[model samples]
Target: MNLKPLKGQHHVSAITANAQKNYEFYTNTLGMRLVKKTVNQDDTSMYHLFYADERGNPGTDLTFFEIPNAGRTYRGTDSITCTFLRVPTDDSLLYWKKRLEDHGVSHEDIRKGGTRMVLFFEDFEGQLLALISDQGNGGVKGGSPWARSPVPQEHGIIGLGPVMLTVSDLGPTEEMLTEVMGFRKKGPYRLEVNGENTVHVYETGEGGNGAEIHIIERPDLAQQRPGRGSVHHVAFRVEDEEELRRWIQKLKEQRIASSGFVERYYFKSLYFREPNGILFELATDGPGFEGDEPFEHLGEKLALPPYFEGQREQIEARIKPLNTKSP
Candidate 1:
């Protein structure tokens, strides 16, 4: 029997000190829409903002939470960090380089990949992140508002291709990704980022698309200190809650130790720390994001889960508004 397809990545959450700067980068510079603007139910002092293509497509999202006074956390072998956005192949890079340059936002020169081209940049908190040239392979739909690069609505990042981590041991982590998560190894390899060791990498394939998970093997690096402005976790998709149970069984059978499942509104999640200290989540696919809000206005306004709705006034008042002047 064929293994069921993972729901694919839903979205990645990043911490941002200057939610405003993060806002401009995702919206104005990167050409995405601010789908949701709500408060973190856990700590409503800041805003949890979401950005994505029209309709707030799942794979196309790059969301952030605004935390102005958070300290810069250290990243090392134990951290699974950064989110990459994919654009059409035609001329997205030219558009981005000029856009960032025009806004005086710092960005690197175009980075060429075997099949994709990437440009890495830091968010306000120095969080490592990038925008990739997906070359229209993913069902990228809708043209971006950024005029520099025009892509017919069909090549944006369809889903997360890969996420990079620096782990102390590759064994358990590899087991989590391949055996537990269903990613097939395309074999170990090196990625020629600028012809230099931009990173130490291992490649895995899902369906036909490939994702390279990088691990920096230096012993000097320490484990991650998670906090605002740092990545809290990375999530992978399962078809439904039933598949979720199977994943739980697989983890137990393998003695991988999980933190148990947690309800995340619209999706159920189970978290476990791989051997390297990277937080990985197994999330369900059904009751898709659309289950919460109508597709047409997924992120139009502050739509809270029914559970959180009772605290709207308190939540709204607690979060400081977007700083219009970040970055």
Candidate 2:
């Protein structure tokens, strides 16, 4: 079977301390739609909150596992360092700078990086994030804007950008991205960290925010301690389950151990760790967030998978209540 390059990021999942706090930040502060409200399948006591653009498109999704007791994230090598969200233009960046400041969310001055300008910031839980100014790079094309968002449609966050991944050594992981995953090396750029670290860029498809990955080699750093505010996994997009099955078979042929095909209600997924021990997922793009509820009423109520439907009341009782009101 002939394999195709991944279209872009399907979603980036992270751990958060509280469901209500996360909901307020993403929906009120960031102005993203709370596309899905569900409980974690592995541990039914916690919530899996999905934030995305209006239609809940794959590349636009940013998700969190709400684990109130999970301690602060320990930053180190072999972890996803920062996630970039694309904005339409430099003016949009300026709008966001003021908006974040008004909300008391401290952010960095806009800085140039290769072909784009970026503004760095952190969430309430210290999860690293950035906003990249896009100059018609197709970042704004696929996503639908939330009509009820406080941010104006012209300046709203469009979709995912280059996700930064820190690795102790770049060679093996580089091979995994290029050879195994069909990404092309797009060269390197310098980033300000403890010191200046060279970050190599890789791309799939036509290469833009959604299709890019930034690899930072940091052998000097310690291994990551996974907890709240840390990225749990980065998922790449596949067209559908047919393509997903092909990827699974290919991983088997390549002797890379994977989670096999797992049904996620809205989408199917296959999980595995990269050479540097960072978790990765290949997820299908179809059977999206509208599967369980009407698009207009998404995230309005706690959604449970079919297996959990029988235990909805108990599961709901176990997890903390969330407020998904619009700001």
Candidate 3:
């Protein structure tokens, strides 16, 4: 059955053991807006925080689920290894290098990631990340940076860039991406990781920095043990609920088991694992973080869907307090 291809990267959700510190680093340090202050829909006992550009646009979102007492993440293959953010220019990389240094955040020198300049870095939890320069990039434009961001608007992150996934074998994963997911193979980039290797690039709608995924095959490594710093899932953008339903049907036709259609309050979603056991999500782009609160005061208070409203008292009493109000 013919279907519309996915637009691009939507959001990446990761695990964070300390919500307070996570907020400090992402908002105060990195200068991303705290778009939503809510709890994990499935597990309301814990917090699910969303950070993004000004309006909490789909492609800009980077979320986290707080799991207290979580263990350390063991780096290895078969993992969603790195998430990237897009900055305006090559000069932005230099600015970020200095900013990261001043914040005592460890980062690598600016270097080439594929054809674009990038600066690799880590968070307090050792979560791997990078900032990719959109110097000569086109297709899938980025989101608007928050004006109130401490990081100057010119140097602030605009949207998500390419995500890197490492797997033991590439055949099944590559086939799933091309045939079922409708991603086109862009090309490969050479790198020396464990040894000399090639990282395959794939893109979906309007192929560019925002719509690409870099896959590296590493049979030499074992499965990654995910903990506080590991990514939980990476979502691709579905235009609307209609498109999301179409995707659900397509997954069934392909005989790939999925979580079916899930109402996320803000947007609908469908969750499934790829051939390598890495979790993947398909989410709608609208009815976003603004649905519950005014755009000007987003993430200022705990927001919950109508279904969870009745249990708000119980939930709030159970979860620890973490203030996310903008000063």
The TM-scores, one per candidate, come to 0.81, 0.97, 0.98
Arrange candidates, best lDDT first. 3, 2, 1
Clash pairs for candidate 2: none
lDDT computed for candidate 1: 0.61
For residues 164-263, write the lDDT of model 1, one tens digit per residue: 6766666777776667666655434455432343454444324322244555454566677765668777776666787777777777777888967677
Off by over 4 Å in 2: 138-140
Best prediction by lDDT: 3
Off by over 4 Å in 1: 1-7, 136-159, 187-212, 226-228, 323-327
lDDT for position 165 in model 3 = 95
**Candidates sorted by TM-score, descending order?**
3, 2, 1
Task: Name the runs in model 3 displaced over 4 angstroms.
Answer: 192-196
lDDT for each candidate structure? 0.61, 0.88, 0.93
Candidate 1: Cα lDDT at 144: 40
TM-score, candidate 2, is 0.97
- Kindly list the per-residue Cα lDDT of model 2 for residues 224-264, writing each as its tens digit: 89888899999999999999999999999999999999999
lDDT of 3 by residue, 1-327 (tens): 767889999999999999999999999889999999999999999999999999899999999999998999999999999999999999999999999999999888788878999898999999999999999999899999999989999999999999999999899999999999999998798854345678899999998999999999999998999999999999999999999999999999989999999999999999999999999999999889888899999998999999999999999998999978662
Of 1 and 2, which scores higher on TM-score? 2
